[model samples]
Target: MASRVTALLLLGVVCFGFAAAEIVVDCCLRTTDKRLPLQILDSYIIQDAGKGCDISATAFITKVGKKLCVSHHSKLAWVKNYINILDKKKGGHQ
Candidate 1:
């Protein structure tokens, strides 16, 4: 019984550590629930911050003067395409 309790305690500690290490990305907006969907980000300037809430991140400044962070591994097609568009905008081609 004592050994089982010890194992459970170790497991709890490990779980807590993993939870604490989780990356927290923020969508800095005036209202908590209000958000402009990623699809409409085509015209927005998405800049690479080099560092973010996670190791890989892209950021953009909102019209409300908030800096929003996006994950580099985002699975959204629009998000990926928008980044490519931003790259092309930087130069003549991507």
Candidate 2:
């Protein structure tokens, strides 16, 4: 049992190390320094930004819902946080 536990611990450490080794690139949106929905591509916000980064419906859902389109949890909170901030700033202030 002790040996088994040790093996499991080592495996856990290895898995975590591999996870750490992965690289992340900024995509459409930003929260802090992360590209929102690192896994999913959502609507481009550039258009509304009056540029070219318009958020597509697919990307919007993926980013907002954490819908792991590509299985990444990248922009998980940015979309929600952005919406929350917008709500408060726009008319839903609480």
Candidate 3:
């Protein structure tokens, strides 16, 4: 009975460790340089490199509920403009 209790405790710790690791994993491993139309985008989330991610990125959610990760350093100015548009939509100046 003692051994069975120890096995269950070990299993619980292993499961909790896996769950914790999943929480910190980066969302975007690769980013796209392609520019998307603002009309299709529903909103955007900024993925900070400081928050366990390798690179800073913008994950845009489309109207149909799809996520598109884009590089923050894309040469085109449209990405920045789109972010501004999204901010304005949320009534935020930043």
Candidate 4:
């Protein structure tokens, strides 16, 4: 019985270690070209390629809670304008 208890404790430790190592890193693997209405957007998160991601993107959150990734280097004027608007809304000067 003592040996069984020790085996169970070891199994638990290994399982916990695996669970801890399964850290989910949310990164945008691709970007969308869809020009969504600015009114539909609620907020945004800027993702950096240097920060565990392969591409730099802007993750825009829609009013209904949907995430749309767009390349940070996109030449679309509306995309930049929307980002600027969101920044201002969040009290960021940019």
Candidate 5:
């Protein structure tokens, strides 16, 4: 019984290590290259599980409640500004 528990613990650690090694270029979204005609409901920066900050990508929640990943590194300044405006409006302070 003790050996079984030890083996499980070891397996869990190995799984976690493998996950950490895997590169998360963009998470929870398959495509982040093209722009989608999605109305922004909310937006924020995605933290790397306390590893560091990812400023290039921001998570966006749509008006219909679908979550999406949007790129913040844009050539147009209005895109970034628009997301911020939506975020502020959602919080009821802007």
Candidate 6:
């Protein structure tokens, strides 16, 4: 019984960690959700470019039943903003 409890506890911990890594947010928006084209992992590696959550514009595309990772030096917020701006400006490549 103790071993079963321990195993369940470990499994819960792992799942919780994955859940946290899979989603990101803004001051008023959720950028990633379960039903999206991408699943984002936690990105904590930055070259001290000064604060306010610097992330990469690129995202790691892990297909179903496959493993993949992508690395890039641009913020996710920047990408969202750029996308919004382009969208608002009647769809031009910026």
**Candidate 2 vs. true structure, TM-score:** 0.25
Predictions in order: lDDT: 0.49, 0.42, 0.78, 0.78, 0.56, 0.38
List runs of model 2 lying over 4 Å from the truth.
Answer: 24-94
Tell how far residue 62 is off in model 5, in angstroms.
0.9
What lDDT score is found at residue 24 in candidate 1? 43
Q: Give the Å error, residue 38, model 3.
A: 1.1
Residues 69-91 of candidate 1 have per-residue lDDT tens digits of 55442644555665666557653
All models, RMSD in angstroms:
10.2, 13.2, 3.8, 4.3, 6.3, 13.4
Point to the candidate with the largest TM-score.
3
Q: Which lDDT tens digits does candidate 3 get at residues 1-94?
A: 9999999999999999988873656478788888888889888877877687777888888889888889873544788888878888883221
Model 5 CA deviation exceeding 4 Å by range: 1-40, 45-55, 73-76, 92-94
Candidate 6 global CA lDDT score:
0.38
- Expressed as tens digits, the lDDT of each residue in 1-94 for candidate 2 is 9999999999999999988773433334432334453244433222122234323221233435443212122344565454454455443221
Give the TM-score of each candidate: 0.32, 0.25, 0.65, 0.63, 0.41, 0.30
Model 3 TM-score (2 dp): 0.65
RMSD of 5: 6.3
Count of backbone collisions within predicted model 3: 0
Ranking by TM-score: 3, 4, 5, 1, 6, 2
Candidate 6 residues lying further than 4 Å off, grouped into runs, are 22-94
| Residues 1-94, model 5: lDDT tens digits | 9999999999999999988884654454332645656454544444334344434455666666666665543543555676557657665111
Worst 10 residues of 5 by lDDT: 46-55
Error of 3 at 4 (Å): 14
Global fold similarity of model 1 (TM-score): 0.32
